[model samples]
Target: MEPRKLLSSLFYFSLLSLLSANQQVVDSAHHHHHHRHRHLFDFRPSKLFVFGDSYADTGNIGRSLAGSWKQPYGITFPGKPAGRFSDGRVLTDYLVEIGTALLLIAAKFVGIKSPIPYKFRRVGGKHLRNGMNFAYGGTGVFQSTSPLPNMTTQIGFFQQLIKEGVYNSLELQQSSVALLVLSGNDYSAYISKNGSSQGFPSFITQVVNQLVLNLKMIQELGLKKIAVTTLQPLGCLPFSTAASSFQQCNGTQNALVNLHNLLLQQAVAKLNNETTNDHSTFVILDLNTAFMTVFTNKGDHLGSTRFENPLKPCCVGISNGDVCGSVDESGTKKYTVCENPEAAFFWDTVHPTQAGWRSVYSALQANLQQL
Candidate 1:
C-alpha cells in the first residue's frame, strides 16, 4: 500500500483500539462505579508522549501543504476541513473525544487527552502536562513521501524537550506513556525507490532494529511504559484490495506484513528481557489480528451494525484516476459520498469511516485488554 494510505488505516486502527479499551472502562464504571474509579486512579498517567507517522498525529501537518486541510476532510465532525485525512475525526481526535467525555462523567478522574503537536508547543503552558505529539503525516522510521521529520528526528524533538526542562525527570518517572506508531511508510519508500522483493526481508530487519533502539531510548528517558503497534495487514487495505475488486487481500503483501510483525514481536520480547525491572515496559498492540477479525466478519462484530460491503468505500472519485475530495480545474467536484457514512466501512480509498472504526474497535476488544 502507499505510505499515506497505510498511515491513515493504521491511525484509525490505533484509535479504535484506544476507544474500545476506554469504552470498556466506561461500561465497567456504569456497572461498578467504585471499582472502575479505583482502576482508573491506579492506572492514570500524568502524561502521554506520541510518536510515529500520520496515524498518531493530532495536527502536526501544515494546513496549506496537506490535502487533509482541504474541504470535505472534516465534514462529519467539525463541519470543515480540520487537518484530518478522513471525512471526519481521525484517530487522535477520537482519543481526545473519549478522554474529554471521561473527564466530564468521572469527576475525580483525570483523563489524558491527545497531546499537543510538537510544532504547536512553542507557546506551551498547562497543556504541557498532557505531553506532546511528535508525529508527522507521511513520515516513517526513515524518510518517506513527506518532508516532515522522520522517526529519528521526531525522537530528537522529544529529547530536546526533556533537555530544556519542559518535563522534569520526576514527572516522567511518576507517570508517562509513550505511543510509537510506525505503519509501513519505510516499506512504501523502499518500494518507490525500486527495492526488490528479495531485499524486503533485510530491509524489514533494519527497520525493526532501529525501532527497537528507539524504544530503548525512550525507556532510558524514564518512560515507565512504551506501546508500539504491530503493523496491520497491508494487503487488506483498500489500496491493495482494489485490484481484487475489494473482495480479497493480496497474499504476498500480507505475508510481508506478517514478517514485519514477527520481527517486531521478537524485538519487544528482547527489550523486555533486557530490562532490569520486574514488570514489562515494552508492549505490542496487535493490529493485524484486529484488522483481520473485522474484515472477515464484514462489520458484523457489532450487533446493531452490519456494513453491506465492508471493502467498498463510502466516498470515492468519479473514476479510477480521481480520489475522494478531488476537484477539477473549473472547481467541479469529482467524488461521490454515500448518503449514510454509517453504512459503509471505508470513507475513502485509504481511510475508514468513523462508523467503520467503531466496528473495528469492537472487533479489537479482546486484544486491547493486553494494554
Candidate 2:
C-alpha cells in the first residue's frame, strides 16, 4: 500500500476506536440511571381503599337505582354511562391520574390507582391488590335517600372481607391508604326530611362525631394512612343556586357547610393528636377550600377557556318535575345536555363535570402532597 494510504487507514481506525469507547460509557451511565430511577422513591402505596359517596364511587350502585348508570354520566370517558355520578371521571379518578403521572419521575413509585368497586371484586382478577371501593351514590356517613349501604355498613363489608381472609392485617398495615369522602348527602337528606334549621347545628355535630369514630375504627383496622375529605361548598351546587339562576349561592346553606367542615377539621386534628407515634396518619383533604378556589376564580384557575358559568350545570331536566337522564314511558328524552361538557363545571344539580374535577384537583396539589 502507498505510504499516504497506510497513514489514512491508521487515522480512521483510531477515530473508530475512540467513538466505540465513548458509546460504551454512555450506555453504562444510562443503565446506572435507569436502575437508580427505579429505586429512588420509596413512597408508593400498594393499595387504595375508597369509602364515601358519589364523588368516589366507581360502580357500586345498581343500574336500576343509581342515576350514574343512566345516560350522560360517563359520556366524556368510556363514551357512555358507567355508573359514575359525573359526566365522566370523578374525584377518585383524578387521584389516580395524579398518582399515575408520578411514575414518570420514579418507576418504583407505581402510584395509587382507583380501587375496584367492592361489588365487582369477584371479577377484579389481578386488580384486587389495588384495593376496594365501598362508596355508593347518594349514601353518607349516616342513612340518606339511597337504600345502599351507609358508611357504617360499608365498613362492615370491609370487615367481612378481612374476616374471610381476603386481606391480612400485615398486608393492610404494609400497603394500604384509605380515602374517605363525605360530600353532604346527609345534609340533603336532612333537609328533605323536614329537619328544622334550629336542629341543623346539633345534627352536624352528630354527623362529625360519628365520622370521627369511623376514622378511628379504620385506623385500628391496621391501615396507617387515612385521608378524609372536608365537605365542598354546598351552596355552590347547582341545586342550591338554581333559585338564583346560578347567579348567587345560598349563604345560609354555605354557612351550615362551613360549620360541618370546621367540626371535621377539629376531629381530624384530634385523631392526629391521639396518634402521635404515627405522626399525621389522619390527613385532611380540604375539598371545601379547593372547590371555592375554582368557583371564585374560574378564569384564573382554569386559564384560557373557563366554565361559562361555574355554578351552571351542563345537564338538566326538560321540566320542573324531571331530572337529568329522565325518560318518559315512550322512552322520550326529558333532559338536555350542553353544547360542550368539557366547558361546563357542574354535570348535574349536585356533581361537578370532569373538567371541573380536573381543575379542582390541580388546585389541591398543595394539600395532596401531605398524602
Best by TM-score: 2
Model 2, residue 50: C-alpha shift (Å)? 0.6
List where candidate 2 sits over 4 angstroms from the true fold: 1-43, 100-109, 299-305, 367-371
What is candidate 1's lDDT per residue for 17-99, written digit by digit as tens? Answer: 21112222222223433332333334456577888876566678887555577767777766887666667765554444454
After superposition of all CA atoms, the RMSD between model 1 and the true structure is: 6.4
TM-score versus the correct structure, for each prediction: 0.83, 0.84
TM-score for model 2?
0.84
lDDT of 2 at 56: 84
- Tell me the deviation in Å of residue 307 in model 2: 1.2
lDDT by residue for model 2 (1-371), tens: 33222212211111111111111222232343333333324445678888887788888978876667888789998789998988889988887657622332223546666789999878746879889999887677785545678888998899888998888888897677787888766766666668898998999898889888889879888887677777777777787788999999777767777677667766665565566444225655656666777787873253743876999989999998677788899999899999998899898887888888887776665433422
Cα deviation of 282, candidate 2, in Å:
0.4
The ten-residue window of minimal lDDT in model 1 covers: 14-23
